[model samples]
Target: MIHIRFSDNNYGGEIDLSGTPGDLRSIRQSIIKLLQAQDVQVCIPANEVKPAPYDSCLNSLVIRKSDCSVKVMVAGSSLKIEGTPEKLKVFADWFNFGDSTESGYHNHFDYYEGNEWVDPASVSLIISCKYRGTK
Candidate 1:
């Protein structure tokens, strides 16, 4: 499964996902579509747009890949989300609040190479985000 975590100072949240490849991909696509559909604007260094009303932003994302599963930690407003590798990838790609680019978000697809559950073919992912206010 994939997981997401959002944290700030004293608050946090998480989301978990478990399903087949198609389901996982669909979930990820939804998140991306939602962000694109929103009226909010993202401020990218190259293409800086005006901030939106909600000011939703993606702070950080941590992706952990394992032999049998994936974990995603998103630290934003103390919110967390979990799901499969495919789903997590979708969230990572579309994770933009008021900014077009995030600070410390990355994907580690070979984290479980030397461990006991190590499987060269197995793949997973994790994500984390940090927000400002309450959800």
Candidate 2:
């Protein structure tokens, strides 16, 4: 669950990405642009505030009938990717966010590792930002 509350009182919202691989992938691709931009803003009307359907079943299915190579999740302002070290390296290689020098805004990717349970390693790449919503 990612709860986004802006510094300004006018902006706030939440998105539950608990077990939705598809949503996670979609969101990852969408926000990849943030690595270059100085700031990106979003707006959601008060009338439109509602919950999306949960993906518990879908997530369970994907995790169950597959090799434990890679799993991705979105937590707040960070992206959590879990898998083997080799697999994680491969993912980092595949994350071609382009040359940062061209954009002038140097981007940084911070990784947090965990050992909640052995075998496939886990890492969380955190990108911190206050939500900016239009009033």
> Of the candidates shown, which would achieve the greatest TM-score relative to the real structure?
2
Q: After best superposition, candidate 2 residue 102: deviation in angstroms?
A: 9.4
Cα TM-score of candidate 1: 0.24
How many residue pairs clash in model 1? 51
| CA lDDT of each prediction against the hidden true structure | 0.33, 0.29
Query: By lDDT, who's the top model here?
Result: 1
lDDT of 2 by residue, 18-105 (tens): 2123323333443343323443322111122133232111111111112346554443333334444434434433323332222222
Per candidate, the number of residue pairs that clash is: 51, 0
Tell me how far the alpha carbon of residue 111 in candidate 1 is from the true structure, in angstroms, after superposition.
Answer: 15
Candidate 1 yields a Cα-based lDDT of 0.33
What value does the lDDT take at residue 14 in candidate 2? Answer: 20
